[model samples]
Target: MATDYQSAISSTLQRIFGYDRLRPGQEAVISAVVAGRSAAAIFPTGSGKSLCYQLPALLLPHLTLVVSPLLALMQDQLSFLNSRGVAAASIDSAQSREEASAVMAGVRRGEIKVLMISVERLKNERFREFIAQVPISLMVIDEAHCISEWGHNFRPDYLKLPDYQRQFAIPQALLLTATATPQVIADMQTRFAIAADDVIMTGFYRANLNLLIEPVASDDKQHRLVEWLSPRLQEGQEQPSIVYVTQQQSAEQLATMLTHHGLNACAYHAGLPAETRDTIQHQFMAGEVACIVATIAFGMGIDKADIRNVVHFDLPKSVENYSQEIGRAGRDGRPSDCLVLANRDALNVLENFVYGDTPERDGIRRVLEEIAAVQDGSGECRWELMLTALSQHSNIRPLPLKTLLVQLELRGVIAPRFSYFAEYRFKYLRDPEALIAMFEGERQRFVQLIVETSNRARTWCSLDFDALYRRGLESGVNAERSRVVSALEYFNDKGWVVLESKRMTEVYAVTPTPLDIDALSDDLHGYFKSKEESEIARLNAMLALFESDTCLSHRLARYFGDMQAPERCGHCSVCHGHVARLPSPAPLPPLESQSFVELCDQIIERYQAAFEGQVPGVDLLTRYLCGITAPLFTRLKARQSKGFSRLEAYPYAEVRQWVSVHLTGDQ
Candidate 1:
């Protein structure tokens, strides 16, 4: 007789997924899951990674909780799972109380077999308790690399996942990702306590992809891209491709430029409205659009097997990132192109982004003091107030503040209370006057006041009730931010507006302990410093791909624990002799032409002169030009100065290098 493992998986693959056989690594990973052993599946993108869990979800008796990185991701996968006639549901802030209750009911009734959620969703006490009632057979972590500090894209929230999983005593766990280095893989294995044999990794070699690197100067990069695409456009060909840019703005500009010049192009980035992003994703997938110019945010949930090409309009920040992005192409095991328009400017931008994360000791100290000052009247446990507090202390945005807050919580100085949005925005599709006219008594007057206080110049307007309350509109403030949220929901239900209230940060309550402010601040500073160094190394690794004479696949494969990787592969630029040799352009301009070098020097001199003993280092100067406010800069309130982003168009490393070389002699 066939064993239970072999018998069940074979039939499920044929019937449920309609696959003739398991993809490489799928069988082993699925086997590990079914046998109740924790495992990490380090498969490349589009390598049937989801099936490893999907099949197990069907096989297991209890609910398999999946934590995806993005909201759209969970929705996309849930839709597919439901279509396959599997019992699945998701509980998130996007759902109403009644809707979430219905999902919770389904879980209680054992009607839902799989539930997907974001990592941050677990922080809510309600969610934690609700999930406690449900039996968790396996906890699946998609994008598992995020759990490790050494990961290319580390998220602090992931560090708590193991502890969270432990609460359930979840019998089995699986970690999955498209890209991970040997170090990242080791980190994940240690975190999950996976055995050597259970940690499955498929080699990162894509033979069908033509990995080509073109070294072009800053001026010619755009033109070179056009020249490559124009012929394909002229032939009236429709090849589903993605052009990855360095920023959301560039995605828009480049996509618009391409559309105007007669190609079916659309821009995809995190900055776009969620609905618009969903539409673009569907359009691109259905072949309604020929290409999408996007940042790194576009391709996570895409499993399209026939992507014809993936063009890097700018250099990627890390080899891990580059591998994950390009892996989207050649998924069908068909010939496809992976082109990188390599240049110096992209490197500067990447380095600048990394340098900006390290805040000064004073800024960290200020944040802690504010948290301590505000606690239970010694502070406010409310997340909204904490955001307002941070704004007053520094120019640190909510995104970085979220990371910093997580670090603080890990240090046990604070305990997380909750998180909510500070404000919300929605577009009124119906007549505002008519809607106001619906209420006639004192209620109508309050409604009118709320509307008048909001920005109604555009069809889409936003309201921050706290501001109205602080500005003395106690009528609406009487209900608090929740009352305003309810009104938005009411209008949404009435089809008066489209609501998008997904922005916010987490709030933590203070623990009963005097924080060793100096030592903790120093340790936090060192943590950020180490992260910056690690990120800088990652960027350099990506650069090495361009500089090295080795096979592209081999270069990538070896990074992910494949020591047996060959030096020469017939598919890459070096092996095929396709690496282009172009002239190095003129160096960055000097002081007279208003170059960043001169601006950097001026900014540094001013800082040192103003603050007697304090010297601005390369990291600090880099952060300023990149519009990144380090703690010291925030303490100095230098973000308000005009010189903050004077040389922003150049690379951070290049400008910083120039400044350091010049300053050593002067100092």
Candidate 2:
């Protein structure tokens, strides 16, 4: 069996991918997948993780559904697959209605073997219904570590993958990640119901990387960076490099600084328009730009192999992040430099970001109160509220709000029903009478009535689902709402019409019981508090690794569950006796000083409407002042105010304590 599998995979590898053989860990993963068993491939970046699924996808009997985190990654993978003559397509927001419709038609016709989408796409009821009709042989979850809340970059939507798998009845699962600790591996195995023995991890040690952790004062980092890069700045002497910063402004400022110092550098961050970011990425990959200053968003889908330098202009969010970011370097078996200019200045801001995501107890309570009100039949179910409006009303950001809803679902408080668009709009490609004439019997009548009932515009027509549901029941055939949707989808598939769905509204049903709203609120708040503490612990652990006396490479390897790594790499800063602890930045201004207090007062007065006719809460105020955006702060555009982020350098706890004292008139 093994011989047969290898023979087939090898031929496919050479013929399609042009690779001589599978990478070290790829064969084991591909073998397991082809044998109809679930497995995980924990290979580092550029270790050919994509091939594990890409190869087997061709061999599978049914469609392979790939869930990726970013559209750029999907595009990259699709391009590679198409270049290799594979049947692949991606359904993302970037595609036009005609394009998406064409892709769906291709999938239905068995012309597309693999489909890539964001995890959020699973929430679309129409898409889910469409997919349920297709047979999915396997589901591949890229960045599988995001499924665990304990992971460094936990995405709430990722938590739904296991359920989605069960919902879709996918026969096999493939979990892939570049960085996963033992704990994260355990979490993934348990969540996906894969046997521990099926997990294959290529260890995290990269011998070709020269890891350097340099502790420098915040004020001197710019000059130090220039000095470090000076040798590589000679004409045509620079290699492709990535300098990572924590914030968008830092990426912009540092890129400007480097360009002034004579390096062709560009900044990439989520704040830039998508087209601009794509252009910058293309330039960087083409060697037109020698260096790119970016936040964490830049490296996910990058496949460049000769990147010689990976510098941390700011401390990474966690050790896991550091490992993953540095893994992008030296992918072609060449020596590359990985540097971290460690300092304490950004610690407050990083910590503040963690604190900001945990909703305030009052906010949680208010949300629970809203739920309770809905339970009493006086208002709409909290789920029925469009997420943006709910966020603005409850003062919870969308991501954290989603987490809270997930928590509620886990506790049996509510369950999400199929979400639906409030209205379906379409533009006709064929005349209504002509299209209706193509059908016969009750179907022809249904199509004719659909056209007659639509609210028409010059070039478009709209159908309200509620009204459609009623008319469907009253039609001569007594058609169901599902039938109406099916007709529209069928028309779309046939290219008779171009359909667009808008105003998606999610539905949920609350489970009735003798409920205690206060207790539930406390429990949910505790969950967020626990998450906040866990995040802070991760940051502290990264700091400890930076300040450790052990070899940087070995320590990193061990942190990611590579126990066999040697005790010393003999090339790191610590190995050379150059270790230094990060220096703390100067203290922030006193919160109780007259001027500071007055500034706080002015801010409170200016944004009092966000407080909802009550005194500003300490947690909310501290979050606002520290540049952490809450729903209310965002809705009020507090980021535009000078007072926002005024005390961002101060510790969140300290700021909260001071705000507590002052707001209560105890200062």
User: Who wins the TM-score comparison?
Assistant: 2
Error (Å) of candidate 2 at residue 400 is 0.9
Q: TM-scores of all models?
A: 0.82, 0.88
**lDDT score of model 1?**
0.78
lDDT for predicted candidate 2 compared with the true structure: 0.86
> Highest lDDT among the candidates is held by which one?
2
Q: What is the per-residue lDDT of model 2 for residues 1-667, given as tens digits with 9 covering 90 to 100?
A: 8788778888898999998977788999999999899999998789989999999999889999999998879999999999999999999987765688899999999989999999988877779888988999999999999999989788887988888899889988999998998889999999998987789988888889988999999889999999998776566887889999998999999999999998788999999998999899999888888899999999998989999999998999999999999999999989999999998988998998899789888888877776676675544344575777777787888889999988787787777777766668899999998998998988887887788778889999988656655776787565566777778877987889998887667777776554587888888899999999989999998999999888988998888898877799887889888786998998656666635465466557756765666667788778877888887876567787767888888889988887777778555
Q: What overall lDDT goes with each candidate model?
A: 0.78, 0.86
Residue 349 lDDT in model 1? 61
**Total clashes in model 2, counting residue pairs 3 or more apart in sequence or in different chains:** 0
Give the residue spans of candidate 1 off by over 4 A. Answer: 234-236, 374-385, 388-392, 420-506, 564-566, 579-585, 589-622, 626-642, 649-666
Off by over 4 Å in 2: 108-111, 376-383, 420-504, 589-597, 603-613, 634-643, 664-667
